[model samples]
Target: MLSPASIVPVILAGGSGTRLWPVSRDSLPKQFQSLHGTNTLYQDTLKRVSDRSLFSAPIVLTHEDFRFFARRQAQDIGIDTTVVLEPTRRDSGPALLAAAMVAQRLAGEGCLVLALAADHVVLDEALFVDACRAAGRAASDGHIVTFGITPTEPSTAYGYIRPGSAAGTSEARKVDAFVEKPDTVTAARYLAEGYLWNSGNFLFPASLLIEEAERFEPAIVAAVREAVELSVEDLGFIRLDAKAFADSPAKSIDYAVMEKTTRAAVVEGKFRWSDIGSWDALRALEPGDAAGNVTHGPVTLLDSTNNYIHTDGPLVATVGVDNLAVVATEDAVLVMPASRSQDVKALVAKLKSDRHNAASEHLKAHRPWGTYQTICRGERFHVKKIVVEPGGRLSLQKHYHRAEHWIVVKGTAEVTLDGRVFEVRENESTYLPLGGVHRLANPGKIPLELIEVQTGSYLGEDDIVRLEDVYNRS
Candidate 1:
């Protein structure tokens, strides 16, 4: 068995979950949202490898837009994670390479790195950990190991891995070949032929992975090495060099290394796993009534069977609906058959083509400080509900074409208008004319909540000119 302290968990948390749109958008993806239970999928993934005896603090690789959210969620669960900010989305190949280099520098060459996707749901935690331990043994013997889930069904959504003869004395076997997602007929044949679903989770020795990457894709290794070398620590995140990272090819780890490596091995994982790629996948995990209906939030079902209904706000009532998935948010509602869950991406594409903001972002936008939800908007006025956490502060900035009115509803607000600084208590209001330098902050122990009304010719976010900021924004 590999030493417990020798394992470093590396989580890949960069993905725009377009297939699960409406609920999952570019601003906040499904991984960061609390979809399954109290904890989000990312939090659940972190908790799986949180055993200090078996794993070290995890390294989270995410996009620049999501760095704060990832850090905040990790902190909420008492996990001390090292966050790495990717300058651009170059897929998992470069991300993993950069993470491997970082892990090697931190824990030496012999250390094993466990790579996992942040969006997957593993129902069986004990079985998952057991498979990790088994993969570690194979990785310790200089083999790059991948956990393969036993095929429970002929699923076309996931790729396949064919296991060969046993690798030494471990339960891991040599990977014969990797197959892409096949048609229903082909998938059935593969399932009957004993093929396993590629779980996309891997365990590899730091030095060995780097060595293989250098052999197969030297350009990727070189670019990522430069990016890592020039990386700088900002706030609490490590920001990779933008130019070098952007120069690297955008490819998945499967294409760049796993499929080409001679040391590839597969470990059979009996744990129940789901990537939660669509609403149908999520509904399968949720508890349903005797009539086969799963409902969340304030939802009422009447004569509904085999339906999934969810609502974030307002009541959603279904009458005589079957085999349907109805998801309602504050600003948008989606109704479709459960079988067409994968078609949500096409719908999102159509929305984006029409320049609909709901396709990419929700009504609520999250910032480093807290969150702001758009209440109403018209031709010349926009209303928003802003929440600021304790010790949170916005940038010292000014808007050119817009004036703002703020009314405090919860805690105290420390306002700085031009050169003047004052405190606005509960139920009090403040105003700033156009081109007036202003900043908002919360100095109290409790969260600060307020309503902001903007009236102007142009109220776009790009109108802001930041003179100073604590959570640096451009």
Candidate 2:
């Protein structure tokens, strides 16, 4: 059996949350955003497993598009991590197998793997760590263990696990069966019958999990094994082979192995947990005022009860409104009854069907260097507010159909125009002629802020021709 300190955390961070629209999109999902406290959900997950005595360095499994986001956020919290990039979306089945393969490569077959979802919130960190240690022990004894949260309510948002009998002398129990999300009546019955909410976190030895997966789905094992073998190191991240990984079927671990295995076990978690899947879930987690209202940012309320109001743009004020959720951002706003928050996913799907830009793209676009927000846009013209961190640099490229003008508002900008590099101080401005090679960099210690104005026939982001890029983007 492996020791408690031999556990390796394999965090899953590639979910594209659509229910929390306007704030969570394909570009920046809910895991990377600060929804609960000061830190993002991803950062919170990292901190939960940061104890060096119990857990080793984490391996974050995410998509290729989110590699930089994962890296930067981990750096922000002073946590070192190994990032694995999945070339495509292939559900938790491939993700877990890939994690096992990577963990085995790093710590050998004897180490235990603690799989965690990056978008969950646990109010009790001490209880969570204790449960992880217990689950690690159970997993070390040749069993695939999953943590089950004690159900505080009849939640239709989560699945349920039926624990059969005790596993040996420990508190862990053998799983009877895994059930899907049930209706209100079924959920209440499950809650009253002493079933636990499936938290989607699992623990097992690397070798044993591979064996179980191979028995249930041999094609997935073959594909993920080859993908890991052919994986390439790019920008300090492991990029799995695209073709080999994509050959595997998209299925969750519960479907591929947990339901089919005989050694499935579960440990009870008494801590408060929530996936934060909808606005109602988030509101229930936060402390409400006297009127049962949860709010964030610049929000004002009068005669509103049981409402959730949030805004990061203009001041949001409400009156005589009850059981509603009003969320507003710089570019979009979502207004719905709190009871119908689950229907936001359908609304997002409708927006995507209509080809709306708000369906996926946010006003603020993040890049490897920094972020740029669209300030204004009109026919034949576009304006942007750009922020570059210290030592950050843009690609050396030229626009095909647009000429640009930049006004530095803060710090200094190292501008490269037509192979001539010079520094522009605060309040200084520079111009880039059409078809001229240009680049932007922040050579100062402080962050550089600038306003960029573009005039051209096409202002689409795809109009750039990259001459060189430090980020290795094509």
Candidate 3:
């Protein structure tokens, strides 16, 4: 068992958010992007629990594809975390259960697990911490505690929690009922009836949560337990057994435990919170100008009223626009009425049906080593700008259908070509013929920047043939 700690933060960071498209894609989700402030939402979440007196080292649960992003982002903020990889998307039921099992195994039976979504924004962190303490007290009393945000508006986007009588002397109250997202009329009535918005964050003792979960969903507990038992350490990450994790049913925590439990409790949270589920929600969180326009990245609003225009691609000038959201990226632009922000998901679904690349990926793709952005691509040629972080290394691989030329723009590049290793300095160039084994790495203290040009009969990512990989890819 591990050392004594009050609460173990279980951060879920594996969501592929589609609602905030163009900026938030499958390649890099909103939690990893600097959306709200200078730091990403995930970093903000990490900072919220960095107080060692109140909490222990966090355990981050994410998908296998986001393993590097989760680990690197935490490292960037100087926060050490235990990264756990989920084999598949089985919803929060199995995810939280797996985390509780892990925490129990490490920190013993009385360890408390706090489930925090990595993508959410909590403005009043002081009040948020206070509420967590209140919830922790209730959880220690054998109650599953969920933080309920006091409703500021009649919002239909979030679920509702009806709190009943008080639980002991703590600020937490017994959960009377858990309600689904209601219609506008029902939402207004709920606001009048003193219901709280379900924030989806939970705190409970590890063993108690597993017991309740087994009482409700025995198979989920069994599968997650076996998965945790069979889990292996992969480069400092815990990779759950794929077959065992996949055997668990896909269900949410509400359906598996909280909604059916008698020991459920809620602590009223007065702090400002936002899930940033849509563009309209994001616009609502920001401050607008005199014309009621929120603009970012070289935007000029002309007679615009209540418009949110953000662009990182080019200068965006709006003329006589109202209640509209214009978002632009390097590869795609989304323009729609701010009121219809929820419909962007349907538009993205249509784009996915049409097999559009922008629906899922961005121009810049992140890898374990660094990042690469496509400058331009044509029928037989592709140009890319790559940035490799200090000490980062790409896989030892080759292409069957393409030849490549790399020109170093920054730092020193340690290049390996056809079993010959050499150093290419700034402004130096190197070439690799078709079917020639090659690898690129940064050996300097600074980031390595390079421009790569590829010429081939068929230019596709599937042409890569990995002879060896440090990340252990197939």
Judging by TM-score against the true structure, name the best candidate: 1
Note the clash tally of each candidate: 0, 0, 0
Q: How do the residues 133-168 of candidate 3 rate in per-residue lDDT, one tens digit apiece?
A: 888888888789999999989998999999999987
- Cα lDDT tens digits, model 2, 1-474, are 345459999999999999999889998999999999999999999999999889999999999889999999999999999999999999999999999999999988788999999999999999999898778778867789999999999999999999999877667899999999999999999999999999999998889999999999999999999999999999899999999999999999999999999999999998999998988888888889999999999988888998999887689999899988999998899999889999999999999999998899999999998999999999999999999999999999999899999999999999999889999988999999999999999988999999999999999999999888988885
Candidate RMSDs in Å, in order, are 1.0, 1.2, 1.8
The order of the candidates by TM-score, greatest first, is 1, 2, 3
> lDDT (0-100) at residue 180 of candidate 2?
98
Model 1: weakest 10-residue lDDT segment is 1-10
Task: Please give the distance, in angstroms, between residue 56's alpha carbon in candidate 1 and its true position after superposition.
Answer: 0.5
Go through the candidates in order and give each one's C-alpha lDDT: 0.93, 0.93, 0.92
Error of 2 at 372 (Å): 0.3
